[model samples]
Target chain A: MHLSPMPSAIVATELSKTYDVKVRDPGIKGALAALARPRYRQVRAVDNVSFSIERGDAVAFLGPNGAGKTTTLKMLTGLLFPTAGKAQVAGYDPWSGGNPFRQRIAFVLGNKQQLLWDLPPEETFRLNRAIYGVSLADYTTRRAELVELLLLGDLIDKPVRQLSLGERMKCELAAALLHQPEVLFLDEPTLGLDLEAQQTIRTFLGEYRRRHGATILLTSHYMADVTALASRVLIINRGRLLYDGELSELVARIAPIKRIELVLSETVSRARLEEYGTVAHYAPPRATLEVPRETATAASTRLLTDLDVADLSIQDPPIEEVIRIAFGETEQDAEEDTVRTDVQRAPP
Target chain B: MTRFTRAMIVLRAFWQLNWLEELQYRGNFVASLLGTIFWLVMAMLTVSLFFRHTPQLGGWGYWDVVVLLGIFNALAGVVETVLRPGIGHLPTDVRSGALDLVLVRPVDAQFYVSFRRLDVWRLADVMLGLAVSGYAFVQTGRAISAWELLAFAVTFAVAIAVVYAIWVTLMSLAFWFVAVENMAALFDAVFEAARYPVSAYPGALRFLFVYLIPIAWTTTIPASALTGRLNPALATWAAAVGVAALGASRVLWRVALKRYTSAGG
Candidate 1:
């Protein structure tokens, strides 16, 4: 059997996932009833998410919790079978691609760990090297490069459990990259990390992409991660893809207004602050105003001259807020057409 | 290279890592040895207690029953050393979504999960069990021939295959029933009956052990080979049983894996 080749690094068509979550009423009575006859509720975790990512591009998957970001990544990595639709990574059907397909891709989940807990991270690296069939010479060279880039001196030798959270995460990234996969699927790679640690990861990822030219599809809750590493963004909510475009375009479309902060030497009236622009917040010595993006610079300049402002700062709305607006507005427009069948169930 | 060779490469790497990790817990080796000795002595004492009342059990002499017990212990050692720490962790992995890591690897997921871990210290149980079998064979005053020794070797391997198949079947149930976290416990409870010859049990229990659970084939046939009780036809049947058991369990494992939803993303 022969087939046409896919040129894109990753392509997904009408990809979807639905989970048959077991449902039971609360309390002891429901428990007994469930044991006698089980009930199942279907939840559509990912709905018709279709997008193609070109090689050598860093794209961020932005969404709130349970917005199908992780689910999409799982399907792309061939971890979860899609309920409907198809996906291809590195020109092969990811679900049925077998070992050759697996060899060409890597996936990293920040919440879960793949390293052996009792052994050092170095041991896991060796295990992966052997499993992936990397030659000993290439393994040594790659190991040294990753260790230096991730700043993982002596950390790989220590037991995984003994390392700090940040240190362990670095080791995890190194392990996942040992084979230098052509495609990367990262879910919340910097979740729960400190500012410094997050920054380190962001920088390393950017450098790795530049050097390897691998296709990267990353999902992160931290806006800093997206702003630093991704040039494009895809927003999903309620199991649907709402927006997919340039990161800058998404920010411009969702949030046309920029935020300007003012610190007055003395108290200021709410009405006076309103004269400059739309007052977002008003207090004794601090106030914030929302101005049109085009007039942000002029407005901030005028605010400093018009008021007894000790300091003033102009900044665009946070990416989190922009994506939140995108989710809320798009959700309302599509809400009438979609049916809700999902109910919350504790993970098994 | 063939898939088998790739699997071997993965296994060697994993075993090396397991050895290194196990070295750190040397204390567990001592504790495990003590535990094995305690259980062995208790089993021997129980056998002695039964022999006091009767000269033979189920028409077999006392030393023959001891030979069966030794075979049973050796099979249990295989479970503890490999299957217990390896496939036994399947339920937990399924519940926690750790199986995702195993599935993403290029190697076969079933092979990776089945032989991922080894309890090195528990291997002593296997040697000790073989030692007991040899000692009891000597006491039985049986003149062993080359044919009997070869039969014993083949049947012993068959015994291990049957036991491994049993474990895979039990553990595969985890994918269907994620909440049943202690499926291995059920195996342990039933495996306790394999300590004695199936003939020593009543008709119903003997049938259950022989056909349904197949614990009888795991120990009895191998021990019978050494004790001069196994016929060539019966040994051939045991090999067939082993092959069939492995084939059935493999099919079950494939079906169960389809049901894996990969919990917690």
Candidate 2:
């Protein structure tokens, strides 16, 4: 199979957002005081964050709560303007309300949807067809295709309020893509979905990207979503871009160690496992060892030969662990490695 | 096809869907019909009560005022059924950031926002109001002339335009004061005065309604045409007012859209 060249789909420079939140204290006294003199506070939701996406690329924006991922998505989708920065989606200034630009993009928020609550998804589809001015032939064909792809058979006729969460999400996706937008911004699209539902949505997203060659920027707390769909990961923390690169590079940058798990034939002492590497977990008949990348093979070989190893396997540390360490949980481990290396290299 | 025909298609789609959706809540039909009747009866009683002490109010008799009240109810129906349900969603949309979906659509955002939804059951008020106005015309024993009918048509259209302008102006403020969640209520508070004819109002209130806030234009000018009391020259002025109202609302909508930094981001 041949690979296609990447094309630029979205760009942003120094994107920033600040909200003027009204501040007031509690109680009747505070209310009276506020009535006399109101106080205002400016909260910086997204501060000078920037990134770009290429066509046909599925990028996952991972961040903790209040990390500005949703804010950045909103600005990129033309839902909100930056407090002070430049941003563009499909060569149109998002804040300008340009028709051509609007026609080229779509947004789906997990918590918020555009479907009319009292009406069936089909009615919304019809309304969208007219609102977007899509041709009847194109609308019918696209609706049929999306229905088949998303498996929205009986769900489309039911009122949106009557659909289940996962079912509604499927309809939301179908409605969003009915116009065939070139750029898709999905915020926590798999949120509130069960495991099977999550897999279904991920599969649909993969197929959608393959078929349309559309640029997708998705944010989700589910790392499985990231690992499955995103070739590239953009990690953000405290409203800053901590890392931006391929998923492998992020894992390598943050976690250079491989974990080796062993199922011992007999109960192995913790000291024996510690001699080979740090014993992350020790239990009867099972032990987990963390070894440096260079010494992974050596440590695994020793565990098999020197210990009562029943079954042994080597794998990268869990991505969740890597993410936690990147957020400063493993600083002591890094410090210990520094001391141990200094001691080893002293006079050997 | 003309722009009007295209707009009609859009409106027809909304109307059909609105009907189907509203049909689910069949109880609301009786509730709304009763609510309209109650308000109509209250308005007639107010006219009757006023006429008990005097035969004419500011030179117009009881039937003329009732005719004006009927026009007021019809315009109110237009507002509650269409404008309020439609444009009233603007403030919440602004607050929750749902307006993003609307702004990105290919159609004109203002036009779509204003006419996208309909409360079909409230349209009963429109028919009932026209019925009351016809009854009052009979009581007045005035032969309806062709010119009066034509003038009434023009002015009633103008009334709709004016009411639409009021809504646009009110909803436009949502952009500036994003926290003002009850902006539609402000329109409702002022629109209450339009239930009475402009002449029944005292000097200060009349002046305020006609000139300052222009709520009186919603019903008084139209009822004037229907009562054969409209000056031919003022009909031209009313048409000009209708054009200016639409133009001003459009300009205000543009300005409001500019200030919308959106809600979430």
Candidate 3:
């Protein structure tokens, strides 16, 4: 992973969290037995994982469910204390919350709202100004800028409960940024938004980053969100950091092949396409092939030269598929290695 | 600026914003005011029923209990206007992880959580309660001295402190027992006892009220001062209890917060 020389906005070392999970059985006898003495099992929610985020970098955190993505964000934002190790945000220890530190950071939870329920989003915006002590001049400037960019003309005046989910999320984002925070911790900011709203928010965040150069550590299940907004990615699985590097680099390393589709002027024989590459899909006048990255050029040339191919395109497989392949191999390795998923560092 | 001044600033901001939000719903003001007045009338009728049977309650005249009842209403007003709308949200915040917003602010979480919201109409309870107390005071035909008035003022401040402390202690328990979201109901149940003087209850119940839960300090002592029945030593004791309650609640809050497992954490 490439990191700028700027001082780190976030530093987490050996961070871990464990919970005492209630264990119950699935029968009347088990329930009666549990009533006599309730049982609990120690479940490690986050293992000893370490990483540093450089200032002004937008990094995506990706993981399957219960993979500790939210737990790590919680510890870094001072909402939860790690059972062990240390974390710092903007040079201030997050667990030891002080106004100066908190004032410099902004966190947005996708489903949760910071806006007043009965009041309009504008009220929440002003409340944030007061809480952060943002000056009147600065608040006005920031509010106008956010309103314009977010297209929040009458939206801010409408009560939060009356707004649509996409509108509410836009207001939530505006509420978060009114203080001009230096760092942002986003947890699935585009969780349930439609495709258009998702693109709008992704574009807005990209602009915000470019404008303020704020350090962003975003965790999202949406591949488009991560791909469009974050240049680097961190993948965690089962409370462990499995991969940390550029998104493209991880994809190249794990899924080293591309898919090619051809539109032929006439029907092409399956045998003819098989001679060039693995025919993944075949139809009367079109075909798709999976070719090795190094051999894709040769295969495309062979197809164009021999066949009446009218049009052709080459594309990488969906990022989700790439990640799935990478995760599958790791899980298999982990199962063989005694199911040890809590490795301290991700394998390069 | 000092932390206290900073809190004052934040409180001012919250108040201004809330007031504006409330302005949008003008009918809420009238509706809540009528509701409070109706409740006050019912309360007075209930007291009259008690007086109809006995000439006095626990050796105190009818008007004396009215004074106590007035003080009770006033304290309840403070809870409604400030403490309830502010710290009353703590349990839900803890459960929903909304406290994350409060915890991240640069301000003192305890102070911010306690004064961030206000039910503007509830302040009317304070005025009406004081009006009733003054009317009952005049009915006693006792010329209250300047010293007694000073004592009343001090004891009233202590009453607010005690009530605030009780709220803090109750809400802080959300950290440990997140599912008990209705802990404020426990406070309301116990506070019902404060509507009458501590001496009016049976011996065991009186002892429990005055010493165990200390509801006596919240309303009984302040009313006692207005009625010119306050023991100087007890007034001093009330002040001490108020300070102690505040200190204890602050300590308990810190300890309870250590158990906070934020949402998705």
Candidate 4:
């Protein structure tokens, strides 16, 4: 028997980051008070989050806004120091600012830019070439390949301010990869892109990963990004890791029910649909039901035979629902019940 | 072949990029040149205004002070060309968390941050300043000696280093006081004092420049070398101060890096 090789790229253990953010009220009195005596509050941006990435693996970090996904990426890339626990990228401590570690990792942020705004993108490329100490020969070859791959021929000569958002993002990706870093941390890489531009970037990233075998940790609010690019997903909420495994496993664990849609030839009573399973939606000649994954096939067969069904299909629940459940939205009633039970049991 | 050579290559790349970027804004070139000329003329008038009151300042004639002013302008040009565009952005970078990109690169962060950007039009100020210094030297009827020329070259390099160290020291404070958006303004306010000879200042300001703030090393020492007024015995002291300034700045940079929690953190 033959086995595939494992690529070990990033290892992190219990990483955390706490920030002392200065807080002051809004008023002249507050301003004078702050000047006389400053006040600070400590907030935990990343609370003991831990995960690992295998080399050549693409992992999606899924979280809602302010869920510490960006903070964790910052820590892994050595942009921020962890208050507790250790993180190592390509076998070097990221926070050390050692040359070897920096050479091995790349970080790209959608909101922030490294390109020289007034200069052409090509100039920035040359600057990166010299700064990263790439040999002239290698620089020429890699640049040609990137320009071709990213389709950045005419865009490269235009000043960055003149380029469209999609063009700038393409050039940004080229700039980040100029040194061929083994580990890549991308935060919201697809944010604010149209459908076609998003698909273009997604395809480019997939191909880049396949060719380079780079370890990639991506964070995005768009579910399509994860479904298309990542096989494994890590879910975090409120600065804590909730789940980490294959994407399929996460769906199975959080939303065990599969959605079945039936296009009936005739209208069906809402009561009849309720007997089959949970009626998520009901309309003319159409009805949707959520059934247990194990019972999905049986339910679909029964619906087809019992009703004059024209068409029918089954799909796993959407990732957004899975994330909402992960964030404790579904457990609200249960939590309220527990609180009520505790209150009744309490002694006076 | 060496790290310094590699750094020079990086600097050259930045210079080319900066030059092309500046060329697009040709109008700024005119504005910058006008600003330099206006300031140069103002400096000369200030010298004349002072000469009206006294025959000499700190035992140096009018032309000698003019030469020092020229050196001051040249150093100011260096600041605008390199330091302002480079380190002047540091506080904002720290606030916005953009400095994270600077830290992750394979290059030395300090070196890259200090020389990564240049404002090309300001190089004109450097040329005009040297020309003014030359004219002042001629007006003083000072014959050029090989020794004096060599001394000027070395001390002028020292002046640049001293200026760079001051910038590094000031900008590094962004790590601790991340909200201070105008750190460069603080430098500008203080550096304005260096436009005049240190000895011409009141006793308290002289002490402040010599010991406390160390702006004396920026222009006065270099001008002394050019005007044949440098005490041969003091050359060693000037060299030592340059070395010490660089060393202290390096240590401060390390400390500041330690203090950086990054933007979000």
iRMS per model, in Å, is: 1.0, 2.0, 1.3, 1.3
- Stretches > 4 Å off in candidate 3: A1-6, A26-36, A256-321, A330-348
Interface RMSD of 2: 2.0
State the lDDT of candidate 3 residue by residue for B12-100, as single tens digits. Answer: 88899779867877898888779878888898889889999999887779889888888888888999999988999898888888898
Alpha-carbon local distance difference test for all models: 0.87, 0.83, 0.85, 0.84
DockQ-wise, the better of 3 and 4 is 4
Off by over 4 Å in 2: A1-7, A25-41, A256-324, A327-348, B1-9, B176-183
Separately for all candidates shown, the number of backbone clashes (residues 3 or more apart, or on different chains) is 0, 0, 1, 1
Q: By the lDDT metric, which is better: model 1 or model 4?
A: 1
Across A230-314, the per-residue lDDT of candidate 2 in tens digits comes to 9999887546687888988776666678889889898778886789988888886888888898999988887777877789998
**Candidates by DockQ, descending order:** 1, 4, 3, 2
DockQ (Cα-based) for each candidate = 0.68, 0.43, 0.55, 0.59
The regions of model 4 sitting more than 4 angstroms off are: A1-7, A31-35, A256-321, A327-348
Ranking by lDDT: 1, 3, 4, 2
Clashes of 2: 0
Q: Give TM-score, chain B, model 2.
A: 0.95
Indicate the docking level reached by candidate 4: medium
Per-model TM-score, in order, reads: 0.90, 0.83, 0.86, 0.85
For residue A84, give model 3's deviation from the true position in Å: 1.2
TM-score of chain A of 4: 0.75
The residue-level lDDT of candidate 1 at B161 comes to: 90
Per-residue lDDT of candidate 3, residues A38-89 (tens digit):
6765667889989988888999998866779999998899888898989889
